[model samples]
Target: MEENTDINLSSGKVESPSGRDDGDKFNLQRKIFVGNISYRVKQHQLTKHFSQFGTVDYCYVVKDHLKKWSRGIAFVTFQDKKSMTRALQATDEELMLDGRLMRVAPAEESKRVSYSEGANWQTRLPPSLPTQTQDGDTCESDFHCSEQVTLPNVSHLELDACGECAIQRLYDDSLMLIFSFLSVKEHVRVERVCRRWRHLAQKSWNRQHKLQFRHMFKGFIKGLTDSILNSLLQRCGVYLRALDLSASPQLLSDLCADSIGANCPNLTELNVSGASVTDVSLRTIAQACPKLRGFIQERSFYVGDKGLTSLFQGCQSLEHVDVQNNAGIVGDCFHSLPTTVKYLNLDHCTKLSDLGLRKICLRCKHLTELYISHCKSVTDQSLINITQNLKRLKVLHMEGSYSQITSSGLKKIGQLIFLKELSLSQNSAVDDGVLVQCAVGCSNLTNFDISGCYKHVTDLGIQALTRCSDLSYLNISYLSHVSDSCVEALATSGKLQSLVARTCSGITDRGTSAEPEHLDTSRSSVTINMYNLSMPHLKADREIMLRPADSSSEEEEEKEEEGGGQSEPVSLCHQSVMAAGAEITSDNEWDVNELDGFECDDYLIGDDPLEEERWSLS
Candidate 1:
């Protein structure tokens, strides 16, 4: 019998005829044989091309035994037999290999001559069948075959079949949705990827409805001019609902304002705080944007009453306005404000007096919140007017305005049963009388601040505040008269979430502790006659330790020595009343050190003061 060359079709190698079972050889037939491959193609390149159909296990390109050059054939074995079947079915037409058409089919076995053993050598042929020439020599070319096969034309292939083929299949809307999550800076970086990605990123950026220029400081200094603002407004301003240009103060002028007014007609909210805007720019924006609802122009020195008048007269849909520190607004200009306004802030407006406030309360009946802190000219009459006219008021801030307001003003404030948040800090005349009135009527109160009113606030005031079942935030710092009794009263409220009582020397550790310990007075219980009749009866029974005298002050030491070395207890009298009387002369001069403890820093270090039954309201 003629020698039959046994070839391993999976590895493209020849083996000697042995007693191996036919089942082992049949299992190796799950590899697809690809032919007509170019000589430049490598094993990895072949595997990469075949991986698109299924997961390939191993791929090998057959080579000559002596010359070590490619034989223009390769075998690709898949992980499963199903992958081999799918690969054969998917490649119905000619497969492209490095710009050339190739043939793909099931691997088969054939006989061939092995060059390593000369004429006597017998081997297996690759996927293509070899033919013999008329010169009595065996060849590997298929030209001598009976049937002819033509190659495909390279120019007729699809253009997207080569580079980045996977990503090119995504639709335009899908691409836009993927790019919309990227920020402005990331969008700029993605534009350099390719022409298609750049087009999609640009389209998504142009459709943005909100833009904040707060972090573009360097760009504002170099490129944000009037022309740039005008160009930006002309491109995407029509779709913008919120625009924040507060950071670029130097670039915002009348020209930029005029461009925004002409282009952004659908804008509902605008922030130009700390910008160099004048009355003309304000009037232009107000006259152009009829749908304007919320405007913030804080710290703009050049915008006066005329601009405010124009804005209120033109924008009937206005609901919120913040013009803090605009000192040019006089009492007469408030008449132009519409009754549709609900929230108004005129903090630090020194020109506004009781007359202007009364006018606001009478005209804006729909107002629910008002902030007039540092308006020194406002007195008790303003609060009376607010309670009588603006029945819908809920939030009021009158801190730092105690020069004219007295305890009588709080009586009118208590009548507003709908009040939820009230801030009367730095008002020297607010005492327990005010708290008594508030507890009787203001049942809906949730937030109260009486910090700096050290004159007459005592434990009795906090005890009276327990009637407000919804009280959550309380600030009574700087009140020297507040003692452990006030803390005890607040602890029992069962709804306090935040409590600040710093600078109150009367609150001992026993009051702030969650679990109080019994005092150990058995060691130094001394009976002495109490000469100070002003001391409370309960304090006189407890053992008191006198503080040491100041050695740096010679007068204090001499006085203590003259009293036969007997130290006196420091008086617990109110510190604000003993001196020139606690008065806030300037808003900047307010002592921040006394109020810093009222923040959340202390709550992070020690136990929270309001940890039990604490709750917060919206």
Candidate 2:
């Protein structure tokens, strides 16, 4: 839930109610960090804007010391910590100052560098110098991880004239702030210190709402058991908000889901992609967390329409839902989706037809991001309906699905001016004229991937992409019609970062023929992967062969999508292999059994033979 931006401004500078002023102290503790202020905003204007919260003592806008350029950040100080607290209460609110929306948060303690009186350079050493093993480590350091750390012998120290303990004099909030900096292991140790310390440490644990299992265990998360999860959740209580198990493969099955549903009632975001959850688990989760906004149960073993329907009916406030690659979902499960949903992913739902999509467009009209990749049943009509209804759509990824979106549907897609990322990787109908319309229409386009559009999208369609000033990430791999000229034009765009041109036969044999050289890569940071090959027999899955280095062996990627309609290229590094049907040979017999895959660079040379008209052998 978003907080209200309504400011509680006061008339003028608030005088300290108790008549104690710390304006001369320059107390960094009682300060707030302000950001996104207009570059032209004066220091006094910032002070005036935040005067409603409390007494403003001083304000300073940060600048690049060398260039003297405004950093658009400011530090506002108050006479007391209460004023700082009042300002931080509106951390999520977009406070406008000088007609520009600004962000505010509690300022961290600042440490000044030793500098000369007039210069910014450090001319002298700082007040304190570091030596080895002076204080102890807070996190799981060497001594703590290797062996048990026994408490050291205590020595009495002098205190104030009064009988009060010196540490007890500090505010409880200050003590809790110190505890918040410690790691989870350190928190357990702090609890055994004393009664007061234990009480404060428990408060810190209860306030910790987000928990990622990967952070708790540095090694393989397979060691995570039900006992460990229940113990941690027992400490976090019902305040647990986000639970992520993406790193823990083969984690607790349905029982794990039941434990989470029973414990984490306040969960807002949950990812169980690595777990083996069933429809019963989803039903339990739906009944427990009604205010869930983002939920992901991708690549599940037993999840289907029955669980998804329960989720939509239970959590009406859901905004982001991803259930990709679950083949069990074959029915109209999208009709009950709430209007509040902004992002939806139904990729690899093979049986989903155009009717289910029509119902989605009619209900979730405010969708901004939609992913229906590898959903072959989705025809041109469903895509046209999406463009007509969802005007706020920004990121649409319908890669590798082989309904082949034609000009009528592509024309409707071009009208989506708000689109930023559009992935039409294997859609056969995205030809030269269709791409020209999209290049002219989507002015805000940044990421465009048309990797396997093949013979249809030539240099004419690719060159048209230069009109998109924001085009950054492009994948032109496997397009036989694309040439060096098209690649050169797009690289000069200055914004292109990742250009995946792995298997273009039209490219020259300059890089691959030599000892792994680059084609003018110094001009830009774009990773131009040009492993030019001519393997027409192989077929790649869009999601399977994307990040080539992720696969442990060749056999793992070849397991799925042999009978799919599209013949997409399987690209990963310099080598790729796609076995069609049961025709996949042994691991030793890839790419004619030579150097195999990316290693056989000599055999996989570019096929743009020198023509007499172009390079005449006179």
Candidate 3:
């Protein structure tokens, strides 16, 4: 049987003016009855209203479950003696409600068999608390994960006390500024110090926070769930400034389509180096992080022309881009990039050509460093255009088979005046005269590469380079006309550190045959001496195998479809699989191979084959 416990809240015992008891008893601590509340009255509403005069310790609204009715009274506990005194002084005897004079006087504690379990008040439980199961066992719910991970046995009072202890130390302006530059991982460690430290870190994070996720992709990706990120941001009240998602292009689409963007409005720096992201992903980034300043990704991340256009138009604040090995990026794409971009790396971009380079030099005037190494299609016109337009251009790299460039083109490059490093290796047109012209035009040149400019390069070229007083590193390897005189001059150049002149037939103290000698007659002989002499780092070697401009082979036809032309004849140095100092086989093999005897000497070394009739030039 349940207790039918009731307190006479209305009729409290009062003493007469003479100080005699009126036979009715009242207990101030047990209850101060306040009446006429509906069952719908929530604890938060009651506490808010009652706590105005004094701090409220607890508020309980009694309700009957069977009939779903309010008990018409609630218990309000004051924090201290002063609070109780203030409450009495501020209120009257009656609380008028529902057109009746409700009671507001202290009442005696209920003494029926037991206290009534009448309060239907909802407990002020933390969000991370466990839920009761059917077997009476408490199991943690998803919401409980955060609580379980937090300090044990922590209560509201303890939180308040701990928070107070940390307030003075954290609110110090100097400490706040000190945490400003800390990385995201370091910030996490600070927050885990103690309950007070955690609260302090949270306050600091909320006020002003920036996350440096540099090289943290592995750990971030492991636990980077939508729920966790959203929860952390919302609770901590922070905006992410730098989000280094380098090499995480695969997550961009998923993160954007979800509410990640809406939650992280302050994102600025982004790095996505290797995840082959497409145009759609870049567009998504533009929409999500409107204030984004820098974005980094590999070429495979872009989808098509639309992707390039979207990034250019959307990320107006963008300044730097590092796109390596992206074959699809063409010359036309330069027009889309923001003018603010100062540093650009299009390294190993095979499809990019001088036309695009010309576009970049003209539009992006502030560009200082341009890296186009291993981009085989760059020509003299492109280099000339860059030198003329970009006055501030400092470093230019055109390494790998720039054979089409002539002395006149290099002379034009000297116009930059401030050009620091110039690389034009494996070009058939480069010779003593070209080197002389380069040395005269660009006196500030510190680094130079005229490698693989064989046959015509002589000691005269080294004399011309003497004018470049600042020349630091020079590569003149495979220039068969160079000898002890040029090497001695380079050795005394004072600024020269590296000088590559390996396999230059002209460098021999004793004269050798101009014609290449045979290594072995057998085609499959692995031990052939000629194989050892095959030059390394020579682009002409690969070019020789490429089908000639007029070849009718299927591979050539395919290359034409891909690159859109039958290009000029290419000079090739054989990659030797023979012994050192071995001679090369006869040029007759050229007729049988896929690429026939269309030679670089015909167009470059000798007089114009076009000047004479088809038979006369030979």
Clashes of each: 0, 3, 14
Per-candidate RMSD, Å: 21.0, 24.7, 19.7
Q: By TM-score, how accurate is candidate 3?
A: 0.49
| lDDT per residue (tens digit) for residues 448-491 in model 1 | 99877777888898789999999998988777787888788877
Tell me the deviation in Å of residue 496 in model 1. Answer: 1.4
Against the reference, the lDDT scores of all candidates come to 0.70, 0.69, 0.58
lDDT of model number 1: 0.70
Q: Which candidate is the best by lDDT?
A: 1
User: Could you tell me the lDDT of residue 400 within candidate 1?
Assistant: 83
